[model samples]
Target: MTATARLALTATLCAFAAPALAQEITINSFGGAYEEAHRKCVIDPFTAETGAKVNIVTAYSADAFAQLRAQKDAPQYDVIHFSGGQEIVGASEGLLLPVTEEMVPSLADLYDFAKAGVANGEGPAYQIAAVGLVVAADKVPSEPTKWADLMKPEYAEHLVLTNITNGYGMIGLLMLNQIAGGSGDDIQPGLDAVSQLLDAGAVVVSTSPEIQAEFAQNDAWIAPYASDYAFTLKKAGLDVKFIQGEEGTPASFITANLVAGRDNVELASKFIDKSLSPDAQACFSEALRYTPTNSKTVLTDEVAADVVYGADAAKGLMRFDPRVIEANRSAWTEAFAKTIAR
Candidate 1:
């Protein structure tokens, strides 16, 4: 061949050998430490394995759901995480796609409780955060074993109660209501109990940061919060102890759902599947103290002790229906406000 012809042949071969661009998908993750752990545990490993790029949008559960509603015609996120049970409403309104075992093979490996919402056309829970009591070990006179213990007169003025607008706070309040003979349809009993506590001097906080501040600055002795937050408090040098109220620990299921109408549903499924893998689950458990949803995920004895590990342990967790919670949320919030105001 002539020199020019040979150069032309080399250029054609180079063009044929060029790599295709990596697939990219956008996902919304919670902010702060949870997102940091998610990056290390799920996103990094997913990229390393699949060669797909994940673009993150940091919005908490309620805000993310609102964004989904607003963008229904032009979906932005491929996958969205909800720690606040927004998936129920999202799935109902057709904002989210139904996740199945066929799409995400690891769905079969999740705990039964973790798969509770899949039949409702929602996503499977990737991790569990048990809502329980976190007490300042040095301040509380004794370790609280049940939800009613918070009502003890001695806890007055040193207790921090979360507002119902927050997910953790919502679960905490529902659990209190359950023990106080109030059902989801009837929150009056719960409100009355909270009013009694408020009358006795317990303070109400609306956000996690505020709760942390109450603990760090105000000598708050006890609070109804999640197990994972106990670790956060401990990391901040507070001597805290997590107690799963003997009545039952309410679970906060963190779910990752596919956004409806997204072009990258296949890629999004892979991302969600990666989160349910034993390795990723274990990473989340260690980093954020979130309980692994994947049944196969193994943990060290220390980590197991901290989370709600194993099938039997998971069976004992209290799971409120997200549908019921969403339905009653508005009226409950109003009643809560009125009660607290008194």
Candidate 2:
């Protein structure tokens, strides 16, 4: 072979070589169907592409974060997934590693909401789920196309609502306030609406069981909740269907973060990049009903119709700043509790 040809062949061979030296990483993230979807869509594909293994250890963001803090000196998991702004708190407190464009080159392509500072400068949002109205298809007296339609007397007292303790719950309240001419720091209109709703017989449910029970046993006909959760109900054999109201949807995300002291940083970053890729992002939207952060991901009409998708779709959704939600979560929780007590 000629010397130039030999050099070209060698370069091509080096380019095909593996990027991640480590073969495994421990990950803490969402479980059950969420995990199943992630495995099929992101994890399995990543393993196939990089010959790396992902060990999913189930835990909520709070639990995983506590564990991360407890084991910061010697990290237990290479990566952790957090929802809402919980991961942002961890990032701000220096519990999670600061993710850079260099580590996960895919970061540059993300939606503004999924960028580093969104997670307090520590992580990137790979998946997002929208908040919408979940209706018992067989029920809901009308077509249920608009957000304001929730106040129709037909739904009064029969609707199952969540408390602000749930992220979407706060979104719902803020939505109501906006509908009633209230905005930021002024949920009094929403509070008044809820008061009227409860007086009219609406039910306030906090936990998941309570939500399912209200639907499964109590003949509850309507609810405002996250798309993933509402889809879970649909899968469980309820006549549940998620709908995007005329006002549009509100969404939050699951942030993938690297642990500060993880040993397999390269592998973790590769895994994160895979999760944010078009193929994996599409999988997330298709399988688990989560929205994709990658702009390149395309979804079928059937799939896109259900979850939040597209630039115009995202821009149209009723999203507030994450910092706003993070700043007032506690106070809003207390206010919601007080309002419910009344």
- Model 1 ranges off by over 4 Å: 1-22
Work out the TM-score per prediction.
Answer: 0.89, 0.82
Weakest 10 consecutive residues, lDDT, candidate 2? 113-122
Query: Model 1's lDDT to the true fold?
Result: 0.88
lDDT of 1 by residue, 1-342 (tens): 999999999998877754332278899988888889999999999999988888999998889898999999998899999987888899989998888889999999998878877867688899999988999998877778899998899997898999998888888889888899999788788888899899999999999889889999999999999889888888899888788888888988899998888778888999999999999999999998988888899999978877888988787787888889877778888888888875
Give the range where candidate 1 is weakest over 10 consecutive residues by summed lDDT: 14-23
lDDT of 2: 0.80
lDDT of each: 0.88, 0.80
Tens-place lDDT digits, model 2, residues 1-342: 999999999988766654443688999867887888878988888889888878889998778878887887888888888876667677777777777778888887787767747435567889887887888888767757777988888898679888888767878888877787777767788888888889898989777778888888998888888787776787788888888888867777788888777668888888888878888888888887888888888999877867888777676555576667767778877777888995
- What is the lDDT, from 0 to 100, of the residue 282 in candidate 2? 87
| Shift in Å, residue 257, candidate 2 | 1.3
